[model samples]
Target: MAQNAHGGSRPGVQPVALAAAGILLLVGVLGFVPGITTDYAAMRFAGRHSEAMLLGLFQVSVLLNILHLSSGLVGLALARRIAGARAFLAVGGALYLGLWLYGFFIHRGSVANFIPVNDADTWLHLAIGFGMLACGLLISGQVGTGGRLDTPIDRP
Candidate 1:
């Protein structure tokens, strides 16, 4: 197996990062599609005034879509290395958690709602945050002999 610069074979971390990146990229693209994003014409560059909702559920603005695209690109770039992939998942997860909290606390239509996150977005952020964090911490390890030790299931 090819070893990454981190001196370990690329294991579960890369795939998790790639999956997350692909989702982000797909979401960003979907946000721009007319039927997929309801009230498409009402989409604004940024701010709570944007009336667009992805799948008629999550509020989305042009700025939010761009952020998703950027995050996907970053994930793709970082997935090249084991350490980078771990960092992407962990740090990205933390950021998503923070976004969830921000969305939950901020009143809609307020200046603080610049990201314009809705209830759907808030809950989705929570899920993504915990999911990413779990993937980052639980899945990381070297492949083969250098990886985590596995115990026999039948061992008492």
Candidate 2:
């Protein structure tokens, strides 16, 4: 299937990167909504004190939502190119994995939970982390037999 702005003859990261970015944007926006995010009023700039939970599942805060929004925007921008997309995924994935590891040390109600990550957020971060990293690592091989594996390339 021919996809992406440059057409289908290239190993594009549109599907995975775009999808991931879109989800992040959606989650970020939803987190701000009152009903969607339970206890929306409790969301704080940064701290475990924020009781806001996105979709009544993952705990969220102003800081968390902002982070999501920012990351999603960056992902969208980077997805325009294979190199950028791969970098976005790889770097972002590593950061998320780091966040996951940090979650282990930050207790549920500890003051150190500045990001206010809970069990749900923690696990989800782990999933996104590995998923992004895997996508980045494997995206290069997505181009079929005739596709150009390099960026800034135009097949004649």
lDDT of 2 at 91: 90
Expressed as tens digits, the lDDT of each residue in 57-105 for candidate 1 is 9999999999888888999999888888888898999988999999999
Per-candidate Cα lDDT values, in order, are: 0.87, 0.83
Model 2 ranges off by over 4 Å: 2-11, 141-145, 148-156
lDDT of 2 at 156: 54
List model 2 lDDT by residue over 1-156, tens digit each. Answer: 345455644435556788889988998899899999998888898998898989899989898999999999999999887688888888989988998998877777778899989888999999999999888887764453345456655545
- Give TM-scores for every candidate, taking all chains together and pairing residue i with residue i: 0.85, 0.84
Question: Which residue segments of model 1 deviate by more than 4 Å?
Answer: 1-11, 144-146, 149-156
Clash pairs, candidate 1, are: none
Give, for candidate 1, the lowest lDDT window spanning 10 residues: 140-149
Clashing pairs in 2: none
Q: Quote model 1's TM-score.
A: 0.85
Q: What is the lDDT of candidate 2?
A: 0.83
